[model samples]
Target: MEVLSIVLGGGKGTRLFPLTQSRAKPAVPFGGRFRLVDIPISNCINADFRQIYILTQFNSASLHLHLSQTYVFDSFTRGFVEILAAEQTFEHSGWYEGTADAVRKNFIHFRTQNPKYYIILSGDQLYRMDLKELLSKHRDSGAAITIATTAVSREDASQLGILKANKNNEITEFMEKPGPVKDISDFKIPAELRQDKNGKGDEYLGSMGIYVFNAEAMESCLANELTDFGKEIIPAAINKLKVNAYLFDGYWEDIGTIRSFYEANLDLTTLRPKFDFYDEDAPIYTHMRNLPPSKMNFSNMNQSIAAEGCIITNASITNSIVGVRTIIESGSSLNGVVCMGADYYESEIQKQQNAEARVPNIGIGRGAIVKGAIIDKNACIGEGCRIGVDAIPRVDGNYGHYYIVDGIIVIPKNAVLYPGAVI
Candidate 1:
C-alpha cells in the first residue's frame, strides 16, 4: 500500500523556554546527540514507509539541515522524503493557524500524490512503534480516521487530549486540555466495556495526537470549514466521518515543557525507562558521525550516557547524558545533567581572559563546575564558572543559566558565560 507520512515539526517549543529560543521543537537536541524528530522518522523508516514529508515552520532551518544529512530517500523508487514549509502557493500566505490548518493548507501536495493513507504525527515525542501495524488497523476498521490513543491516568489527562469512544472503538467525543478528573469520568461509555484492563475501561483512552486518515475523507474534510484538528476538524468530522480510536498502551511522552524534557532525559538513565532509546527494532537515529569516540581519562563517570566523540578529562560525570564531541576539562564535575558539546578553544592550556581575547566557538575552561544542569550545544564557558549551585534562581536571556524549579540546570546554546558567574 502506498503511504505518505507527514510529521509535524513546526512548533516553536516556547514552553521549553531558552532551549527553543533559537531552534524549533523538532530540532531540539535530545538524549545527548539526537533531536526529538528522530523518533518518528526512525519509526517511518523501520516500518518501510519511505515516502515522507516533514511539515515544518518556525526555526526550520536547523531541522532542514539535519534532515538533509541523515535521511536519503531514493528517487528511483516512489519513495522520497522532503520538508514541506508553509507558504502562499497561489492560495494563502500566513502563519500556520493550528495543526489541522497546517495540513489543510498543504492539501494540494497530498492530493497530488493520491496515496491510499495519510499518517499524521507530531514531531516532538519519544516512543517506539510500528506504523505498519497501525496502518493495518486503520484499514481493517474501515474508519475515515483512526487516532492513536494511549491509556494515561485520569490525573494526567489534563495535559493531553481526552477521547471517549464507543464499543465500536469509534471516538464519540474529544476535548483538548479539559481540566479536572470529573470532566473525564463524566463522559458516557457503555458500562459493559467500563471494566477494562485498568477497571476504567475506555475512559482511559487519551489522544496521542497520532492519526491515520483515509486519503479521500481527509481531502473532503479539508474543503470544509474546519481549520484546526483537535479544536475544530476532528470534532466536526466525528458525526459525519467514521472516526475510530486504537488503544496503544506503550511508553509515550510529549516533551512539551522544560520540566518534561528534563525528566525524559533522566528517565533514560533508569533501569527500565518507559521509552527505550536503544531498542534494536526501532533505534533512534540522529546526526553525530562527525563526533569523535568518547574518551574517558581517569574520570569518575557512572550511570552516564556519553554520545559519540566526547572527551572527558579529570572531571567526574555521574548520572548524566553528554552530547557528541563535548570536552570536559580537568577538575570539572557534572552530575544528574544533560551536557551539550563544549567549546574547544577555552581549554586550560589556552586561557585568554583579556577583553580582546579571541574566544573559541565551543569551550569550557578548567576549574569549571556544573551539576544538575543542562548545557545546550556550542556554548563557551570562561574559567571558574559555577552553574546550578546558587540558592537563588538565575533567569536571564536565552543564554542565561536557569535553575530548574526541580533542580536541573539549563544553559542555552551559544551562550558566553563570563568568569565567576554563579548560575
Candidate 2:
C-alpha cells in the first residue's frame, strides 16, 4: 500500500517555556543527543515507511535545519522526508489553528502523493511502534480510521483523550481530557482486553495522538471547520465512521511540559531506563557529528550518560546526562542534572575574549554544584555556582537568565551566569 506519514510539530510549547523560547517544541534536545522529533521519524524509518512530511509552524528554523541535515534519503529511491511549513496562501492565510487545520491546509500538497493511507504522529512524544503492524490491523479490520491507544490510570486518563472500545476493538465513545470530576467509569477497557486483572483499578484506553487514516476518511473528516482531531474530528468520526483502536502497551511519554521533560531526561541516566536507545536493531538516528570520544580526567561518574567530545575534570557526576562538546571543570558536582552541551568548543582566542568581556565561557566552571535541573545548550555555569541545591524555595517564573518551572531550575540557551551565582 502507498502510505504517507505526517508528524504534527506542536504549537507554541508554553508549558516548556525557556527551552521552547527560541526553538520549536520538536527541536528541543533530549537524551543527550537526539531531538524530540527524532523518535517519530526514526519509527517511520524503521517501519520502512519513509515518504514523510513534518508539519510545523512556530519557531521552525532549528527543526528545519536539523531535518535537512539528518534525514536525507537515497537518490535512487522515491522515499523522502520533507517539511511542510505553514504558509500564507490565497485560500487560507492564518497559521495552523490546530492539528486538523494543519492537515486540511496541506491537502493540496498531500493529494499529489496519492497515498492510500496516512499515519498521523505527535512530534513531542517518545515511543517506538511498528507502523507495519498498525497498518496490517487497520486493513484487516477494514477501519476507516485507527487510533493507537494505551492503557492508563484514571489520573492519566483525565489528562488525555479517553475512549471506549467493544470486544471487536471498535471505538464507541471518545472524551477529551475529562477532568477528575468526570465520571468515566464506562470508558474502561473491556475485561478481555485487560492484561492484568488483579482488580487494582479501572483501566481506560488513552489516545496516543497517533492515528492511521484512510485517504478518503481523512479528507472527509477535515472538510468541516473542525480544527482539532481529539477535540472535534475523532469524536465526530466515532459516531459516523468505523473507527477502531489498536491497543498498545509500551513505554510512551509525552514530553510536553518542563517537569515531564526534566524527569524523562533524568530517567535515561538510570541503570535500566524504560526507554532504551541501545537497541541497535531499530536505532534512533540523528545528525552524524563526527566528534571524538569523551575524555574524563579523574572524575567519578555513576549512572550517568556523557555524549561525545566531553572533557570532564575531577568532578563528581551522578544520575546526570552531559551532552556533546561539554566541558565540566574540576571540583564540580552534578546530580540529577540534564546538561545540553554547547554547539561548538570555545577556541583559545574566544576564551581570551570571554575573559576580557568578564563573562563565563560555555559549560560548567570549577567548584560548581548542580542538582535536579536542566541546563540548556551553550549555558555557562560559573565557578562556585549553586543551582537547585539551596533550601530557598523558588516560585515558578522567569528570573532573567534562568527560570523555575514545576520546581525545576531551567537555564535557557546561551544564558551566562557569572562567578558565585546561585539559584
Candidate 3:
C-alpha cells in the first residue's frame, strides 16, 4: 500500500537545553556521527516508504540543511524527503500548537498525494523499526488507526501515554502522563503479548509516539480542530474508530531529556549496546564527510566509539563517545562522557574568543579531566579544566557555567570552559 511518513521535528526541547539551543532537537548530533533525526528518516527509507515530509518549527535551519545534504534520491525515482516548516496562510496564521495541529496544517500537502496510509513518527527518539510491520498489522486488523506500543515499567508510566489492549490488541483505554503515584494496574498488557508468555505481564503498555492512520480516518479526524494526538486525537479516536495496538519488542529510547540523551550515547560505548550502529544491513545514513582515518598517538581507550577525523594524543578514554573532527590533547582523560566534536576545523572566529563571546572550535585541551559529562559541539575545554567532577549527585537545575540534569554536567553548544575551570 502507498504510505507517506510525517516526522515531527520536536519543539523547543527545553529539556535538552544547550544542545537544542542552536538547532532543532532532531538536528542535535547523536551517537557521535548521526543526528537524532536520522533514526526515523532512515527507518522510512529502509522500509521502502520513501515519500516523507518533516514538520518543523523552532531552530529548523540546521535540520533542513542536514536533510538537503543527506537525503537525495535518484533522478528517476518519484520519492523524496522534504521539509514542511510551519507557515501562515489564509486559513491559519499561527504556529503549530500541538502534534495533531501540525498534521492538520499539512493536510493540503498530503491530500494531493492521496496516500493509502499515513505514518506518524517522532524525530528525537532512538530506535530501529521497520514500518512495513506496522503497516501489515494495520492492514490485517482492518483498524482505522494503529498505534505502536512497548511495555513500560510502572516507574516509567509517568513519562509516557499508557494504554490497555484486549486479547485482539484493540486499544480500550489510554492515559497520558498518569503521574507515578497513580495506579494503572488495570491497564497492563495481555499475557500473550509478553515476551516471557507466562511472565508478570503487569507492565503498562506505553505509546512510542508512532502511529499509522488510514487515509480516510486521518482526513476525517483532521476535519476537527484537535490540537494533540495523545491528549486529544488518539484518545478520542479510540471511542469512535477501530484503533489497534502494535507492540514493539526492541530497544526504543526517548531522548527528550539530557539524562536520557547522555545515557543513550554512553550506551553506544558499552560491550553490547541496546542500539547498535554497527548493523550493516539496516545502516543509519548521514552526511558522508569522507574524512581521513582517525589518528592516535599512544592513546589508551576501552569500549569507546571514536568517529573519523579525530586526533588523539596520549589521552586516556573509557566508555565514551568521541564525535567527528575531535582533537584531544595529551594528558587529558575522559570517562563515561560524550564529546560532540566540532563540525569543522579551527577557524579565525575561534582565535578571537577573548574579543567576542565564542566557544572554542577544538574539542579538548591538555591536562583536562571530563567524566560523566556531555560537551556539545563547538566547545573548547581549556587546559587544567575539570568537568563533571563537581556535579551534584542528583540535581536538575542550571548552574552558571554548566547545567546539571540527573547529576550529569552539560556544557551548552558553542560554550567555553576556561583553564582550571571546574563544574
Task: Specify the highest-TM-score model's number.
Answer: 2
Query: lDDT per model, in order?
Result: 0.77, 0.92, 0.88
Q: What is the TM-score of each candidate against the true structure?
A: 0.90, 0.98, 0.94
lDDT of 2: 0.92
Query: Residue 187 CA error for candidate 2 (Å)?
Result: 1.1
Where does model 1 exceed 4 Å of error? 188-203, 288-290, 342-361, 393-408
C-alpha lDDT of residue 71 in model 3: 95
lDDT of 3 at 24: 91
lDDT of 2 by residue, 1-423 (tens): 489999999999999898999999999999888899999999999999999999999899999999999998888668888889999999999989999999999999899999999999999998888889999999999999999998888877888999988879999889999999988888877766675422436488899999999999998999889999999999999989999999887788889799999898988988888789999988999989999999999999999999998999999999999999999999999999999998999999999999999898899999999998999999998999999898978799889989999989999999999999989
* Residue 238, model 2, lDDT: 93
Clashes of 2: 0
Clashes (N, CA, C under 3 Å) per candidate: 7, 0, 0
lDDT of 3: 0.88
lDDT of 1 by residue, 1-423 (tens): 478999988567777867787777888888877888888988998998888888877888888888898887667667766888878766778878778888988878877887889999889988888899999999999899999988766666777778888878989888887776455576534455543444443355678889998988888778865667777778888889989998777677888877789889977777777678777767777764765678888889878888887877888777888887787778877777787674332445554453357553264556787777778887866667888755755443343344343345676787777777777
Model 3, position 101: C-alpha lDDT score:
96
